[model samples]
Target: MVSPMLSMNQATIKHADLRQTLDTLTQTGYHSVGLWREPVEAIGVPEAVRMVSDSGLCVSSMCRGGFFTMPEGPERRAAIDDNRRLIEETSAFGCTVLVLVVGGLPQGSKDLAEARSRVAEALAELEADALAAGVTLAIEPLHPMYCTDRACVSTLDEALDIAAPFNPKAVGVVVDTFHVFWDPNVLRSIARAGREGRIAAYQVCDYRTPLEADPLLSRHYPGEGVIDFKALTQAVAATGWHGDIECEIFNRAVWDTPFDEVSRHVADAFDKYVAPYWPAE
Candidate 1:
């Protein structure tokens, strides 16, 4: 049997709309899903909520709401406001975690430190709203390769540091293997995230060396790449957090496959690479 803890992140089947995403997951034995903003918005939140509610799949989190790398200006202000709306949508789904892919450096700007500082500033601006909504803004640090264009926060430790000043319930970190598995300090950071009450989400995927041209799409099924899922899963379990484990693959080729086929593969991969290390419920 597939472990009930498994959750299919909607990104794993990017071509599917809200209904297809939900139907495919439930039909494939998944008990939950990690949501993304675009798909939820494509069908509108009200309709999306109805479909999700009827699907019987738990909502693990909302995929993203951060791109505050732009310096303070009208653009940055708008980004923060949009995040508030995203937080409300997350709450509407009865989910509390909102994963943040904090943006990398701004156009024509090269100061990495300044960009990171702005992320902290943005969090401060949004924390009150997050706390009020009972949602946690889960900062997701992408791998260093993405530092130039995707996420500036490139390590678990950095994510935690950005989350440090805010209340854990309002601001926390997302431990995603595609992004964090490469960190030598990752295990310690994961333990610290748990200790600090900052582990809002745990996403799994593998990373292989010969990355795709579009490196963001390089995520692979667990055990297919070099990641050590057993060690990562064991560390996360030891922290006493039993949240849903999301299999969030982003490969374009995976997206082209039939949803059911992709899902079966994800399930099998998780069973081989992850489930055994997960403690019994």
Candidate 2:
């Protein structure tokens, strides 16, 4: 079997410095890393690019550039402009995919359909710029739990529908195990995304029980929780996806561990639970 390239998402080691994270990833044999926009921006895009490039590691994807559900006003316009800048940054880093966590309802509003509609409109507005920048806008469907605040796009199918009107090269879907594993139709959605050629990124992380108060940080490493990594990995492989499988956990416990040790654990988990499902050579 030919294992997919493994990538470490910056969120996995949120407490570590970007340079230290990159260094640890390289030392642990990760071929690439997924960067978070906040940290990358904190270091300045050019320097962040230089740091990763100097480490000889490729960027798998940039963690987010979407939040268009706000009320139309300066805030909304600013969000779009910020996303455009994020697209440029992704291009500057030579990364092809920029993950988008399309925002949920505007404050004091509960109309999900409206929020979803706004997301579609936002994608249309950014599609041309995404193409121009050579960056694919990867719509990440966060778990239903995040539907009220983080992302209204809560399933791969919903994300695909949002990307349907645009060229796959300009818009695609992110298949994140931690978020989509609970979906009854996820397997079908994966197949559909593959057939449509809109699977831009595949992120792997387990879902823990007794969810954290801030569920956003509830992600666990592969095989550490209830996620059936074997099944999910096989499903992704069945789609003929050959992209990097990023390990992006947000657990505070994992973050507290030493970055080097965390890197080793991530590599071992990928080899154990994920690599076995790789398509045969």
Candidate 3:
């Protein structure tokens, strides 16, 4: 049986559409699913919701909805507006969390600090909208390698600092293992996030050496790499935060495989490396 605490994120099967993603999860006995906007939008929200409901799977947050690192301009305004629409879509799914990927420095910009300030500014602009929609913006800190082009916030501590000024319910952080496993202060940061009640989501994925040419595709199944899942999951559980544990893989090999095989692999890996560490009911 699939662990009741497990939810397979849609991004693991990047090639699958809404229906295929849901089917793969259910076929493998997963109890929930994490969504991605592109696939969800491709099928339209109403139909996507209907299909998710039909699958009888608990839905997690949208994969992402933040990239407002640009200095104030038409582009920044447009990003905020698009995120507002994403918030509405998240609410439609009845999920309380909407993940944010605070964008990196704009082209021709050498000042990383200024770019991060823009992330803070963008959060301020959207905090009220997120609150009004009853959705929490979960800020995801990608690995430092991605700081220049994907996400500027590369540590949980930094993500939390950026979120500190905003209401915790309206803005929060994602403790994704792949990005944070390398942080020496990660344990301290996890404890702090729990104390602050700011862990919007907990995601599990392993990282290995010889990263792909596109490093973003370097994610591996739990235990397939060197991360200490037991340590992190135990720390997250220590907070009395019992939410679905999402397996969100981004490896090209995993995606290139058939969805059914990928789902089974995720289930096996999650059960072996993650579920055992999760707190028991």
- Model 3, total clashes: 0
Who is ahead in lDDT, 1 or 2? 1
Candidate 1 on 82-199: residue-level lDDT in tens? Answer: 9999999999999999999899999998888989999999999999999999999999998898897988899989988888999999999988888888788999999999999999
RMSD after CA superposition, every candidate: 0.9, 1.6, 0.9
lDDT for each of the candidates?
A: 0.91, 0.89, 0.91
| Model 3: colliding residue pairs | none
Better of 1 and 2 by TM-score: 1
TM-score (C-alpha, index-matched) for candidate 1: 0.98
Q: What is candidate 2's lDDT per residue for 1-281, written digit by digit as tens?
A: 11348888888999877888888887777788899988888889889888888998899999888999987899999999999999999999899999998998899999998999988888889999999999999999999999999899899999988889999999999999999999999999999999999999999989978998888889988988898888888888898878888989998889899998888888888888888787767
| Model 3 lDDT per residue over 1-281, tens place | 88888888999999999888888888888889999999999989999999998899988778789888887889988999999999999998889889998888898997889988998998898999999999999999999999999899999999999999999999999999999999999999999999998999999999999889988899999998999999999999998777888999998888999999988888899889998887678
TM-scores, each model vs. reference: 0.98, 0.97, 0.98
- The true-versus-predicted C-alpha distance at residue 170 of model 2, in Å, is 0.7
Name the runs in model 1 displaced over 4 angstroms.
none
How big is the RMSD of model 2?
Answer: 1.6
Task: State the displacement of the C-alpha of residue 251, model 3, in Å, after optimal TM-score superposition.
Answer: 1.2
Where's the lowest-lDDT run of ten residues in candidate 2? 1-10
